[model samples]
Target: MGRVNTGPSDPTAPDHHEQGNPVTERVVAELVERSNTLGSDPRNTNFAGGNTSAAGTRTDPVTGGPVELLWVKGSGGDLGTLTEDGLAVLRLDRLRALVDVYPGEDREDEMVAAFDHCLFGKGGAAPSIDTAMHGLVRAAHVDHLHPDSGIALATAADGERLTRECFGDRVVWVPWRRPGFQLGLDIARIAEENPGAIGAVLGGHGITTWGATSQECQDHSLEVIRTAERFIAEHGRPEPFGPALEGYEPLPEEERRARAAALAPTVRGLASTDRAQVGHFTDTEEILDFLARAEHPRLAALGTSCPDHFLRTKVRPLVLDLPATAPLEQVVERLGELHVRYREDYRRYYEEHADADSPPMRGADPAVVLVPGVGMFTFGKDAKTARVAGEFYVNAVNVMRGAEALSTYRPIDESEKFRIEYWSLEEAKLRRQPAPKSLATRVAFVTGGASGIGRAVAERLAGEGACVVVADLDAEQAEKAAAEIGSADTAVGVACDVSDARAVTRALEQAALAFGGVDLVVNNAGLSISKPLLETTERDWDLQHDVMAKGSFLVSREAARMMTTQGMGGDIVYIASKNAVFAGPKNIAYSSVKADQAHQVRLLAAELGEHGIRVNGVNPDGVVRGSGIFAGGWGAQRAAVYGVEEKDLGAFYAKRTILGREVLPEHVANAVHVLTSGELSHTTGLLVPVDGGVAAAFLR
Candidate 1:
């Protein structure tokens, strides 16, 4: 098993990563542990959704005087992976003092800039917008969390009355307000007025709890959340979402997934109209349950109440109009019209609320789409984002269930959602994100990707930010190769016999669901039987042609069909060999199939040009070391033909080349990247040789 290396800076054991003094060190250690424990479970917090802090005294380096500091979760850091480095340590005295000169809620965005001056010496990380909430709360330790159970009570129509009934005076209730310096000050006042209260439910938001000690704070946080969950279970009404729609019930597991796969490209295409997007399909029980309910459409239209959620999931989802049991073709036919209607509705919403100072509409495309029988499909610029958005929506569904069980589910209105979605502060945060890699929004499929040249090609494309699907005849090895490359969001492995038309279609379906659709493909699956025409059996010729020439043809045809559905131009590259043009002894079958593959590249390029699909080829020579074809016994046979040992064949072949240099799998992979990099957009029917200067194999 592989292990992730953790060191001094890592806070796995509180003592390993310490602070200025024993007191400060102990507090910091507990803060990190509490944050990680709470963050690990989705029940406590969503990814990067909550904030935690510990207030303590630290020795000032220059003055040698005791200074009050606040160590809080910082911008863009997840609580599950919270380390000392992810915390922003600032002078509490300075941060609190800013309230005296505060310019009010209208100019609250300026207060974030002022936070820089409050850093205690060198700040650990940039303080998040929630810093004020943590700093101003009257306690040694504080937590601001968005637990589904807590949010349910927070967003209920009779939330204040229900909160009083649930916890009595232990947890008070605060009304809705956009988080800022003013909200922080407001929470501080509420805490002071209620001496018996341990926390407060922030209406239309989440929960906030505090304690004089770290353990007390965490215990209080969990107690509040657990109590809320139990209260809902005991007192909540049955069938809160209303009864299931008869024809919209979830389908069987296998059929559900198949339909999800079939519809992925069309849904992804509609979602990516403004810009290319990666998709995630979710079919959890809760998702299906919500979709089947009659009240879901009405609730989904109102959107999520929590700021953390709608920011990732968008203001609302695009619910499918047709029934879940509708035929695949029928659903596909109606999608275009449905997408246009959603776009127009979004445009009207923007125009109705946008002012002269508001930023231009970012996108009209829907980020989430609901399919009753199938599931939910969410889109983002990359896979991780898409997956997280889906998770947030699930949290929203749970909240709605609990809220509706208690009373009417009344979330925040559209005006507030609009203000937060297009907030100037939010825009600045987006601008700060790092630029995307060349193939950031692209997905690639590599044949024979379990080993050798195909594996190299898969790794190369993945490094450039393309989601990769490794397809090979060996199912086990294909999955292993994918795991080594990255997580499921970045890569997946599938077993495929490229020459079989049905198998090829199934593989394409997998790709469509895994990542909206394919943007690039490399046809590199092949094997060689080194024998003269007279000595070669019919089986040898058939195997070579089936895997190389015919296999490339089938994969290309299927990929092209899916790409056309996506309405996105794509790339198809064939890893042909130099022997396609050069004749050599005892290589009749291998060379003939390569020649067939080379011709297919030209044929497809001419035919696919109208669709903006670029078909190209990379021809390599003497890939002896680290080659799957050679490892399968071709190396020994080729050595015998040249009167040399198996290991010496590589050196012999290299010495004969014009440049006397060896060619490796990576060199061929580089040529594929060059062709599909979008730099040579107009270049097709082109073959680049990675043969170390082979004059005989050179294209005329």
Candidate 2:
């Protein structure tokens, strides 16, 4: 058996963490431990839905001066098995100072300032919505998540009443607010209101808890949720109702486009002036109800997104008018009448609720206009805004219909809507400096390009208007993939063992000569050995490392030199594996070499980043339909070691993924594009796991 490396013996029985208190260590440990329950947590019924974070000051190994706001859980990460660094670091004091400013004075400028300060030095991930919220908590540990049980309670009628009954004396409740800086500030106010309050629940939102320790906070989260669930069972369900007009169908593209365009100007004039903002269009409820009974039952019930989305969608669109322009003044007059009724109803709602505060609301402008003959138009400030608005409306429609099956759909109240609409934190999030898509005119050379992820990335780059060269050890296969992609520059297939210096050099020359110059390079050709470490010889280690590790270096070095000479920056990508972090039994050499491969990318990044060249790696776990890496029929050997019949091989891998689906070559290719494209301009020296939550368990 291979011995796992143990660290050096302690000179004395000193604390493992010099800076943390015993209690702090215990809290962090418990939080870390409880969080491990995330993937398997009954609360996350969907594959990846929950999140977590931590905040504290620590002596930096390099800078040592009380580094603040060390790390927080990021988007697309499961808090369950997360480690310290998995959370991105942001300066808390800097963020808190940002929140204190009167953001409303110049919303956009202040918001962007927050993004610049909070996410400036972050890596692969961006700062999540809860960043400012965590900043306000100012606790050593903080955790957040959208728990189903809590949502179920928050979504019910009289949620506040029920909430008061359950933890009336325990958790403080903040009215609904859009997540981000506004929500953070709201939570801070609640925290201030109740000095010793352990946690707070955002109405129609979710629950948040903070403690000096991770475990305390985590336990608090669980307890608060359980309390809400108990509160609901005792209080009664919302009134039952039937869904309104549910039949719907997606329109033909030509018709849809024309309709959207015709209605576009109307929506823009009524809302924000962003034409790229398109709205969700659907037939009248009467027509939809008729469609529900059609043979295409599945296609008939398409609906919108969630309840809060009503703010963007209005209660529903008036599906009248055709070919769209009914004079702006006349349209405005009719819309004005409807707006008056909406305002009256809203005012009455607040007046009836004795405990609520009253404020003049932004007039209800129909965000989405459905012109029968034309289609639907969405209003927003930009393309992103339009898309989000459309999606939200769709989600709202869906939630409304779904809840009708059981009861009323829950919508966040006016206070929450107002808070989010003008939320400084959200504005800050929008200010995030987007990654540049600079590879538009660049050239890329990829190895193992005949098929699988290599081919996919090449095709994606080519699609994005880049000149790509598809190279492989197998010239025939490479040429085949090149032809499939049909690049005008034509991806030339050159045969060469990436491991051989002479072969790599020749391939580089051919690729450079064909493309004129190379700006992007993917060292994707690699292999894996499944033998145990004891069985893994010096030769096995040398062979795997040479191609996966050293081959990467040789290719990067040549690409770097070309980019330098051309006076343009470049990028280098690597195809790594999940085994790098979680080495499966018996594959010792493959794992160690893969780990070193990651290190190599980081090292290259540090060296080349100064030259305007970015180097990064893609670590994919269980890439099905990938290249020959797992081919050649190893079923017999795998069966022998696994002690199962060859037929069980599929199940073995399937059971390992949290998503219950195999990773695809296309998935890996997407990550490659994101990193190589301008979308992640400042991103470098990063390792991305394209495995759907596999590393969560591995690192745990």
Model 2, range 23-122, lDDT digits (tens) per residue?
3354345545656665356452122334565554444456555445435666545565565545566665566667546355335334534655654253
State, as a TM-score between 0 and 1, how close model 2 is to the true structure.
0.40
Tell how far residue 278 is off in model 2, in angstroms: 14
Please give the lDDT score at residue 116 for candidate 1.
88
Off by over 4 Å in 2: 1-36, 39-51, 60-70, 74-86, 91-129, 155-157, 180-182, 192-197, 230-235, 243-410, 413-700
Clashing pairs counted in every model: 0, 22
lDDT of each: 0.89, 0.58
- Per-residue lDDT tens digits for candidate 1, residues 1-700, read 1111111111232322224567668888999999999888888888989899998776676776756778999988898999989999888778878877788788988999998889876748898888888887768889999999999999999999999999999999999988777778778888878979999899999999998878899999999999999999999999999998988899999999989988998999899999999998999999999999999999999889899999998889999877888988989888888899999999998998899988889999999999889999999989999999999999999999999999989999888998989988888999899899888989999999999999999999999999999999998999999999999999999999998989988888888888878989999999988998799999999998999988999999999988888888899999998998999888999999999999999999999988889999999997998899899999999999999999898898899898898888888889999999888998999989898888999898
Candidate 2: count of backbone clashes, pairs at least 3 residues apart or interchain: 22
Candidate 1, residue 620: the lDDT equals 94
